[model samples]
Target: MTKNKIEKIFKILSKQISNPKTELTYKNPYTFLVSVVLSAQATDKSVNASTVKLFKIIKRPEEMIKLGETKLKKYIKTIGLYNSKAKNIINLSKILFEKHNGKIPSDFNLLTSLPGVGNKTASVYQNEILNIPRVAVDTHVFRVSNRIGLVKTKNPDETQIKLESIIPKKWLKSAHHLLILHGRYTCKSQKPLCGDCVVYKHCSYIKSEQNKKNISSQ
Candidate 1:
């Protein structure tokens, strides 16, 4: 995509989603970390449904440690891979309390060092909790970015690098949320709502589809 088109894509999206934020509900960084961990292979809706009551009771790392893995599993059992997620949450909570003074570290290295917290999770936390400008390349972001021709990466890591390099510095903080929302709501995986898309005029996927249709009709 040209720099101007790239800028316009974000401009239109920002106007559409004025108050973009993580859909996962959380009381604080500790809860946000736990929610992100549970969100692996699970939806934000699912994580929020379970964490709604859990966040009310346990608001800190120490509180999560007290809840124990078994009870934590019970709370997040509705989520995918509850057994493993519960264990990682319990272990990471213990580490955070013991080493980091029950605080979510702002440092990317330390955040990713936590169990179940990978590059994507750390980026999301940094973007949302730490107010950092990072592009967390989730499934939605990867698909949307490539389909829109902003990037043509095969993996999330490449997509993250390409997006950060090309995306406007001012839009960095909100770009992650915008791309995710676009993919989740409009530019879906199986079938994108091209008619409703604001940037469809600049969409390579849409143009390619049109080309294919014209050729087939001929």
Candidate 2:
């Protein structure tokens, strides 16, 4: 997209949701990291449900370690990929305690090195907790960006790079949340609510639909 188009898209999305935030519930950065880890291939509602009771007991890294892998698995088993997530969380907490003095690392490489934290999760940690201008391209961001003509890419990694390259710097921080909310509510995978979409005019998917309708009418 052109610079002017990018700016316009950012302006519209920003106006729609001024202060977008992660739906995952957490008290501190440590808990937030764990929540993001558990959120891989999982819904925020599901993560929140699991964390609600889990967080009450395991607030700090030490507490999480104390809970142990077996106990952690019990709390998170309801979530998909619970066994591995439990191990990662426990191991990551130990690293946080030993290395970072119980603080989440700010550096992306260091963050990604932790168990269960990939590029997307690291970006989320920086964006939500640290307020950094990094767009974490989750499934929602990927689908919404492609639908809205913001980025046309095959996978999440390519989508993230495309978005980082094009999206205005001012909108970087809230971009993930805005795109996520859009996909979750409007531009859904199964049935996008094109009739009510705020950016329907600029949406490539909707334009394609309109073209089909026009052709059929002819």
Candidate 3:
């Protein structure tokens, strides 16, 4: 898509989504990182459900390390892959406590070096906690960007790279949350609510479907 169209789409999205932010609940950076880590294959709602009580007790890496893996499992057991998520959270907490003096690293590479933090997780942490402009391509972002023709990519990594490069700098900070909210509520994988979508006119998926319907009618 052209830059002008992309800008218009984002402008409409920005207007529609007045407050574009992460839904995951956390009190501090440590809890936010843990929330992001636990949210790998889980929904933000699920992560928040499990972390509600857990965050009250564990605010820092040292506190999380003290909680240990076995006890941590009990807290987040409702989430998918909880066993591995617990282990990684505990291990990463330990690393943070020992190496970084119990503070989440501002460096992207340092954050990615943690046990469960990958490209998406690290990008999210940087964008949210460190005030960085990063398009963390989760399932929602990947699907929405492609469907909108903002990017034509095969994988999340490629999608992230392209989105970060193409999205306007002014909108880059909130783009991640904007796209996620759009996908979660409107441009869903099954039976998308195209009629209610703010960017419906700019969506490649909608345009293609309309073309198909017109062809069929003829």
lDDT of each: 0.94, 0.90, 0.93
Report the lDDT tens digits of candidate 1 across residue range 1-218.
Answer: 78999999999999988988999998888889999999988999999999998998999999999999989989989999999999999999999999999998999999999999999999999999988999999999999999999999999999999999999998999999999999999999998999999888889999889999999999
Error (Å) of candidate 3 at residue 200 is 1.0
Lowest summed lDDT across 10 adjacent residues in model 3 is found at 198-207
TM-score, model 1 to reference: 0.98
Question: Which wins on TM-score, candidate 2 or candidate 3?
Answer: 3
Estimate candidate 1's alpha-carbon lDDT, on a 0 to 1 scale. Answer: 0.94
Model 2 whole-model lDDT (C-alpha atoms): 0.90
Clashing residue pairs found in predicted model 2: none
Cα-based TM-score, every candidate? 0.98, 0.95, 0.98
Q: Deviation in angstroms for 57 in model 3?
A: 0.7
Clashing pairs in 1: none
Tens-digit lDDT track for model 2 on 14-70? Answer: 787777788999989999999999999999999999999999998899999999999
Would you list the rank order by lDDT, best first? Answer: 1, 3, 2
Ranking by TM-score: 1, 3, 2
Supply the TM-score for candidate 2.
Answer: 0.95
